[model samples]
Target chain A: MTVPVPFLLGAAALTLSTAMQSPARAQSAPAPQIALSCAGCHGVGGAGEGSVPRIAGYDRQAFVDNWSAFRANARPATIMNRIARGYTDAEVAQLATYFASLR
Target chain B: MTRLTRRAFGLSAASAGLAFAAPATLSAQTQARLVIIGGGFGGASAARYARIAFPNVAVTLIEPKTSFVTCPYGNLLLAGERTLPQITHSYDGLKARGVNVVHDWADGIDATAKTVRLRGRATVAYDKLILSPGIAIRWNAIEGYTEAAAEALPHAWIPGAGEQTTLLRRQLEALPDGGVVGFAIPPNPFRCPPGPYERISLVASYLKRHKPRAKILALDAKDAFSKQGLFQDAWNELYPGLIEWVPLNKDGKVTRVDAQAKIFETELGTRHRVDVGNVIPPQSAAKIAIDAGLTNETGWVPVNPRTFEATRARDIHVIGDANVGQVMPKSGYIANSTSKVAVAAAVAALEGRPAPEPTVYFNTCYSHVGPEYGISVVGVFRPSENGFVETPNSGGVSPRGPLAEQREQRRLEALHADAWYGAITRDAFS
Candidate 1:
C-alpha cells in the first residue's frame, strides 16, 4: 500500500544509524504506515510482552534475511512464513528499517 | 475537508448554516476533525491510529459504553477458561492518547451535514466520519426469534455489555448432565465465520469435564465454514462422539425457535428439544448505517476498496463489520487490521492528498479448541476489479495433526493467542 503518512520526515537514511538507541530516535523517521498492523501482535514499538518475541531492536540485516527466508519457505515459523510471502521486497526492507530503528 | 451538512450540530438548522459556510477557511486553520462511531475493535483502532500516525487530526470516538467486552474470547468464557473482566477494556487508554471519548449512544447520523446525533440530546460534528458501527442482530429474522425470545435462547453474538454471553453461560451451567445443547447457526455474510465452530469446540471442551454425558448439536446454515477441516479434526480428536454437526444439506437450517418452549425447529419441520439453545440469528449493518441511507440491499455499506470510504457518501469511511468487506471475514482481527488503512485514507483526503494506492489487508484468527490447543487461520487479501479476493498461496491454516507430535506448536499457539489479545488491546486502547 502507498501509505502517505502525514508525519513524513526527511530521514533519507533508510540505513540504520548507530546513534539510534530508543524509540524516540526513530520518531523522526516515519514508520511506514503499512507496518502499523504489526503492533497488533508485536505490541507498541514491537516490544512484545508475551510469548511473541520482541522485534524492536532486531538487527537490520537479520530482519531482512529473516523476511527473505520466511518468504522463500526456507525458515521455520508459525505464522510469519505465510505473512511474509504477501509483502514485496521494498515493503520488507521498509519494515526492516522501521523495526530496526524502533528500539 | 468534507463540506458539512446543515443538520445535527446540536443547533437549529437555521443557525447551522454559518458553522459550515466557511468550511475552506475554517478547516485551514483548525486541525481536521475525525469523528468515529462505535468503540469496538475497528473504531478503537481507528481512533488510536489517527492519534498516532496523524496527530494533526482531532479524533473523537462516540460509543455508548464506557467499557467494551469483546466477542472474540467470549467462547472461552463459556468454557470457563476466562471471565468477562478479562476481555472487557476501558477507554481510558484511548482517552489518555488525546482521543475524545464520549459515552453516549449514536442515535442517528446526518450524512449530509457530517454530524452524528447522540441519544443524550447532543450532536457531534466531524470533518470526516468513520462509521465502524459493527453488526446489528436482525430481530426475528428467524421466525419467533424476537428480543424477548433472546432471553431464553441467547444469540450471544453481539457482545453488548456482556449480558447475552453471560446469560448463555448461566444456561450452560444450569443444564443437566445429560442434557442436549442445540446451536442454530446463521448463514454467510455474518460476523466471524469461524466463531460458531469455535464456540462449539469450547462448549464441548467445557462439557467433557463437567457434563460428561452431555451432547452438543450444532446445526449449521452452511455446509462448510472457515477452517472447517481443522475444527472438525479437533472435534473428532478431542471430543469424539460428543458433538454432532448438521450441515444445511442434511436438514440443518433452523427456521423457527421457541425460547420459552426450549424447542429448535429445523427447516424440515423436525423439532428438537434442548436444555440450552444458542440461536445465532442473521445480522445486518447496525441501525445507524441503515438510517443514514448508507446500506444497500445486502444490508451492508459498500465502500471504495482503496479508501474504505462509503461508496454512496463522500467523506464517510465505513470500516469494520458494517461494511460489505466480503472475502474478509467479519472478525475482530480484520476490523483492527483494516482500520489503519481507513484512517490513512481519511487523513489523506482531509489534506487533499491521494488515497493509499494498494489494497492489502491481513487477518489472523486464533481459536482455542481444547486445553493447551490452539489453531489459527491467516488471510491476505488484495482488491481486484470485481472486489476483494484472497491472495492465493499466501495464507493458510495451521497444519492439522494429532497433539502427540504437535503438542508444542499447539501449546505455543495458545500462548500466542493470549499475547495477540494483549498486544491488540494495547495497540487499540492503550
Candidate 2:
C-alpha cells in the first residue's frame, strides 16, 4: 500500500507527486509517525523496557541487517520474524533511521 | 535526551505538526474540535493521543462515569489478588492534558448536524466524532436472562467497579467447599475473547485456597477459544481436576437459565444445577451505535480498515468492540492500539490531509491462569484491500510445553501482565 510522504521533519522537500509515491518507493517517509505505535511494547521512543529491547539510537545498518535476517527466516524469533515480513526493505531502512535519530 | 518523558514526547509531536503545517487543503484554523465517546480504553486513548498529536485540537471525551475500572485485570480482583481501586482510573490526567473530560452519557448523535446530545447537558458539536462505545449485552439471547437476572447471575463482562463484579466475587466466596460453579460462556465475537477462561482459572485459584474441593463447569457456545491450549495446559498443571470445559458439540450451548433455581439448561435438554451461575450472553454494539444507524447486519459497525471511519456514516469513526471486518480481536489492547490509528486518521481528515498509509496495528492479550501463570496471544495487522489482515508469522499464542523455560516465561508474562495494565492505563488515562 502507498503512504503519502508524512509531513514530518519538514514539507519543503515534498511535492504532490513525491507525496503520492508508494511506501515501497518512498524510502524517506517520516519514521516517528510509524514508530509511535511501537512505544506500547518497545518503550517510549523505542527506548526499551523490562524484557523488551530498546531500539532507539541503534546502529542503522545493524538494525536493517537484523530485520532483513528476520524477514528472510535466517533468524529465530518469537514475534519479530513475523513483524519483519510486514514491512518492505525500504520501510525498514526508514524505521532504522527513525530510531537512530531518536537519541 | 536519553529518556524521553511523556511531556517531551508531546512537545516533539506538536512541533512536528507545526513544522509541516499539514497539507495545503487543510483549513486555516487555530482550533479544531474532536469529540470522543466512551472514555474506556479506546476513547481515552484517542483523546490522549489526539491532544498530543494535534495540540491545537479541542478534544472532548464524553463518559458517564468519572472513573473507569478496566476488565483486563478484573479477574484478579475476583481471585482476591488486587483491589478495585487498583484497576480503577480517574479522568483527571486526561483533563489535565487539555482534554475536555465531560462526565455525561452521550445519548444521541445527529450525523448531519454534527452534534452529540448528552443525557443532562447541552448538545456538543464536533468537527470529527469518534465512537468507541464498547459492547451491549443481548439480554434475550439466552432465555430467562435479563438485566434483573444479572444481579443474581452476573456476567461481569462490562468494565467498571460495579455491583456485577462484586456480586460474582461474593457468590464465589459464599460457595461451599465442594460446590459447583457453572459458567454459560458466550459465543464468538464477544469482548475479551479469553476472559471467561481467565475468570474460571482465577476463581479456581481462589477455590483451591479457600474451598479446596470446589469445582468449575464451563459450558461454552463455541467449540474452541483463544489460547485454549495454553489455558488448558495451565489448568492441568495448576488446578488439576478442578475445572471442566464443555464444548458446543457436547451440548455445552446454554439455552435457558433458571436464575432463582441456580440451574442452566443446555441445548440438548440437559440441565446442570450449580451453587453459582455466571451467564455471559451474546453481545452487540452499544445501543447508541445502533441508534445512529452505524452497525451492519451482524450488529457491528463496518469501517474503512485504514481509517476506522464508519462505512455508512460520514465524519464519524466507530472503533473498539463495536467495529467489525478487522482480523484483530475485540480486545482492550486492540482497542487501545486501533484508537491511536483512528485518532491520527481523524486528525488528517480534519486537516484535509491524506490519511497515513500502511497503518500498523498491534494487540497483545495476556491471560493469567493462576498466580505467576500466564499465557498470551500477540498479533500485528496491516490493512488489506478487503479489511485488516494479520501479518503472517508475526503473532501467535505463548509457546506450549512442559519445559522449564516455557514455565518461567509464563511466570514472567504474569508479571508483564501487571506491568502491561499499568503501562496501558497510563498511556490512555494518564
Candidate 3:
C-alpha cells in the first residue's frame, strides 16, 4: 500500500515546518503547532462546520488581511480580535500560509 | 528476543523511515501504532488530528461505547432546548478517516511493555499511547453517596451514554409544580468548573416555564466558581427568587446525602429536603489511569508541560481532565485543544525530537444561562515553569451588563454557542 506524502514524513512534520521558516522565525515554533489550536473552533484542518467560517484553502493574502484587521480591531469579532492579540505577527503569517496550503 | 526488546526495536525502526527526505518505504503493517484510550473530546480529537497530520502512524481508539454523548451541552437537554440525539456522536467518522475504532473497554495498561490489555482478553501494542480516559466520580466522596445511591440521586456528571442526563430530566418532569430541587455542588478542580452552575441555570429555565413556583437550592461546596458574577447576575434577572445559591462560608458544603429520604445534609448538620436531588461528587482520573500507576496521590497524572507525557510513565502521554494542568480549567475545550499538542509531542518523541515548544493553548467555554441568553469565558495558556500560565491580557469573560442593555449581545452569543458545538463535534468525530 502506498502511503500519502505527509504520512511518509511522520514526525518530520515538525522538521518540515521548521524548514519553511523565514530568517526572523528560523528558530520559532512550527506553523503546524500553532495551526492546531485553530482546529478547536475552526474544525479540523480549518474546514468550517455550521456558522464557523472556513479557513482551509483560503487565499493567502486574504488570510493575512483578515488577521491584520482583527488584530487592529478594525473589524468586528466576538472572539477573534481577542485571540488574535495573543499571537505574534510572524506566527499569524505562518498560520495564514499553513491554512492556505490545505485542500 | 524479549517482548520488550522486540517492541523497542520495532519503534526505532519505525522512526528510521520518518526522516524529512526519506523514501516512502513503510507499509501498513510496518506503520507505528498510536493507541488512544477513551473516546471523549480528547481521544476523538487526538485520533482525528493524528489521521490528518500523521497519516504514516496507524491509530487505534479503544472506547467502550460506539457513540459518545458530550457533557458540554448536556445541560441544554435539561432545559428542553436540545435532545439526546443532538449531543450523541458516532465513531463512524473516525473510522471513515482510517482510524481503527475498537469498541472495547481498556482494562489495563502496561507502560513498560507498551501494550493495553482490553476487557475482551486481547492485548494491543502501541509504539506510543495517548490516555484521555476523562474523570471518574469518586463515589461516596459525600457520605451515603455511593454508586447505588446515584440511581435515585443522579450526579449526571459523566457523559456515558446520556443516561444520567436523561434520568435527571425525568426526575425534573416528575417533580410537583411548587416542589424544590436541590443540587450538591462539589469543590474546585473538578471537571468543568462552571458546569454545575450552568446546570442550575438551565434547570431553572425549564422550571420557570413548566413549574413557576418551583425553587432551586444550590448548595455549593466552594465559594467561587467560573463566571460567578455573570451567573449570579443572570439568576437574579431572569430567574429572580427561583435560584437560592448558598456559598461555602454560609455552610453550603454538603457532607452527607440521604438518597432515600431525598435530603442533602451540610457540614453544619443542616438537612435540606427536596422533591428532586442532584449531587455532583468529587472526582479524580479514571480507574484505568489509577490502576496503571500513572496517577499521583492527588489521583491525577502530572505531565511535562510541553510534552504532556506522564511523569511516571514512558512512551505514554496523558491529556484531558486526567492531567494536572493546574493553570487551565478542566473543560472539554481544553481537552480538545491540548489533544493535538499531545499527539504532536508523542510523534516527536518517537523520532527523538524535542516536544513542540512555546505552544499556546486556547480555550473558550460558552454557557447558556437562559433562553436567548448566553455567556462565556476565554483563556489562553502557555507552558511555564513545570505547568501552564495564562497569557496576560489575552482572554476575558463576556462584558457584564444589564439584560436590557445587552440583549442582542446575549442572543448572538447563544447562537454562537450552538455554532461552536456543531463545529467542535465535527472537528472531533466528523
Top lDDT model: 3
Model 2, residue B237: distance off in Å is 1.5
- Who is ahead in lDDT, 2 or 3? 3
Clashes of each: 2, 1, 1
> Individual DockQ of the candidates?
0.27, 0.15, 0.25
True-vs-predicted CA distance for residue B114, candidate 1, Å: 1.4
After superposing candidate 3, which stretches have Cα over 4 Å from the reference? A1-31, A57-74, B1-29
Residues B348-381 of candidate 1 have per-residue lDDT tens digits of: 6654456665557888899999998998988888
Model 2: per-residue Cα lDDT over A1-103, one tens digit each: 1123244522332233245445553433344455666766676556676666788888999999999898887985545665677666676877888887766
Candidate topping DockQ: 1
- Model 2 shows how many backbone clashes? 1
| Model 1 spans > 4 angstroms off | A1-28, B1-29
The segments of candidate 2 whose C-alpha lies over 4 angstroms from its true place after superposition are A1-31, A47-54, A58-62, A65-87, B1-30, B403-405
Which 10-residue span in candidate 1 chain B carries the lowest summed lDDT?
A: B6-15
Candidate 3 per-residue lDDT, tens place, B1-430, comes to 0132222222334444555544435332455679999899999999998877665578999999989999989999998888999999999999998899999999999887789999999999888899999999898889999989999999999969998999999999999999999999998789998899899999999999999999999999998999999899999999999999999999999999999999999999999999999999999999999999999999999998888899999878999999998889998889988999999888776654667665888888889999989888888899987899988767778778899988887887787788789878888898
